[model samples]
Target: MDLYKIDKQNMEKIIGSNFDLERGLQNLIENNLELTLGLEFVASEFTVGKYRLDTVAYDRDLNSFVIIEYKKSSKYSVIDQGFAYLNTLLNHKVDFTLRFNESFPEQKKVEDFEWGQVKIIYIAGSFTSYQMDAINNPALPIELFEARKYKNGYMTLNQIMKTSIPARFSHTHNQHKREVADKGINIDNASELTAPTEEQLLETSSENIRDLYQSMKDSLLEWDSSFEIKPTKLYIGFRLNHRNVVDFLPQKNALKVWMNLSKGELNDPEKLTRDVSHTGHWGNGDYELKIKNDEQLEYILSLLKQSWQQHRIEH
Candidate 1:
């Protein structure tokens, strides 16, 4: 993909620019972690054992620590380095807790952190085919983000998404035992780290609610090929470039959606969205809406389009 700059009737291609991996990109991302990625900034160049992390950010939604690495070139293995950093975090939980506490004393208890969903992100100008192939497996909790720097101080983070990989096994003790033995590492169990499937998440919902959720989900996917659905323990998140645009929390009778837009950014003429800026919510965005039926489905979708358009790289 390419970027362009428009001036009145004239248009010009914005050439990609080089940047210092640490000083330029890393610092910029850390400074706007919450604004850009919806993550809380924790520390930079944080050392644990022999490894020094490029950036350590906290995800309050999942209550997990995020490890981010910036790569100027695609020379190293993303899987090896991602897991190595995750392994370090898993082994030395106390050190991470201390670091978080030192940085944010008012935050939640360290024991309550969700270690099961620890995510590692690798950001670079581009990824090789080998690097893309390495993350095709669903067993890994890592994400690849392609970063681009243009002439007019524009930076884009595009997540390279992989096709869906079916889960190896679910709800079988024997399978779990085999996976445990196969890992051979004295680490946490594999079941705990495995992300729940969409079916598993909607199992408790009523038939009507499930149908409604599916309708909205199908519509979102039909909007574009870039739209991807990620089902987490808390909610089903829809994203472009791995940056969440909207999140859905399904109940027995209703589906709640949290759009990833700021307080005043949303253009809600129907007045269906409530201000959730100061209130504690399970999902992102300042706008929250609940749908019990398909009465306002089209209107709701129009609102979602606003969010999707705002987050992507504007032409």
Candidate 2:
């Protein structure tokens, strides 16, 4: 279980159970590549130039990737290996677009995708002091996680170290963009706003845009009574009238209502996230507020109220 103890028997046993060391590490590196780039999961492995990576994780929100080299048996110097793959990732980022276009052929505005950060991860049962010291002063931005295996062979990867949590989420409207964009920030031109583009056109005639947002926001406030609106440059987060929905344990299977306006269907689509486990679609079109039903809403409010009240007492 504590594979990090670095004993010969424990290390070898884990490698034997997990992989031919080399083969098994390669499989995990390929499969969980998503963890590197902060995406949910890569869903598959891919080659970088001539060199194959253990795993290549990509996060769509960050528009970034990570190179993973897993060591099932013994440790090898990954500096050169990770460096090679990192270069290739930066080089062939456009290939992602090509692959994407194959799926959705009409994606002409593909240049908007921005590449963020790349992390290098070493997943293994053990790491030598020398290896740890080497990674301590990384040449490129990298993170190293050590996987500890149990007697039952239940391996849990523990975060040994991380570069920073700046890239935690995919939403980027500020500094992250400045780093990715080779060019300095360009000021928005007022004249450009006058120009008519398809994106602008779609939002122009939508009557339900305001009406829908107000209705949804009002309903949330009505339910929680204290649901205030707070907008950030990226997306909105809320203090969630937790007093009302404190006990609402939302699960994956819970009917979650997400306000999705079709991409390319409109500019400034009325995008919101609502759990629709019980609520019906409110109104229709852009004004469509999908939450669970009235009963569910009441339950959510009750749970949130209890949570907020508990917090007040704790504070």
Which candidate number has the best TM-score? 1
lDDT per residue, candidate 2, 179-293, as tens digits? 3232222222111111121222223323443333334445556655544232211222233321112111122222222332222322222333334334543211121223433
Model 1 TM-score is 0.73
Error of 2 at 219 (Å): 30
Counting clashing residue pairs in each candidate, in order, gives: 0, 33
What's the CA RMSD for each of the models?
Answer: 4.7, 13.8
Residue 310 alpha-carbon offset, candidate 1, angstroms = 7.9
| Candidate 1 per-residue lDDT over residues 1-315, each given as its tens digit | 778789999998888865665468898889988776778998999999879999999976667889999988789988667767776777788899888888886755657787777888888888899999878766567889888887556888777877765653464334433543355434354555555667777888889889988888788778776676777778888867547788999888888999999999999987999999999988889999999999888999999988888877541
Candidate 2 regions with alpha-carbon error over 4 angstroms: 1-19, 26-38, 41-45, 73-75, 99-110, 137-139, 162-315
Full-model lDDT for every candidate = 0.79, 0.42
Full-model lDDT, candidate 2:
0.42
TM-score of 2: 0.42
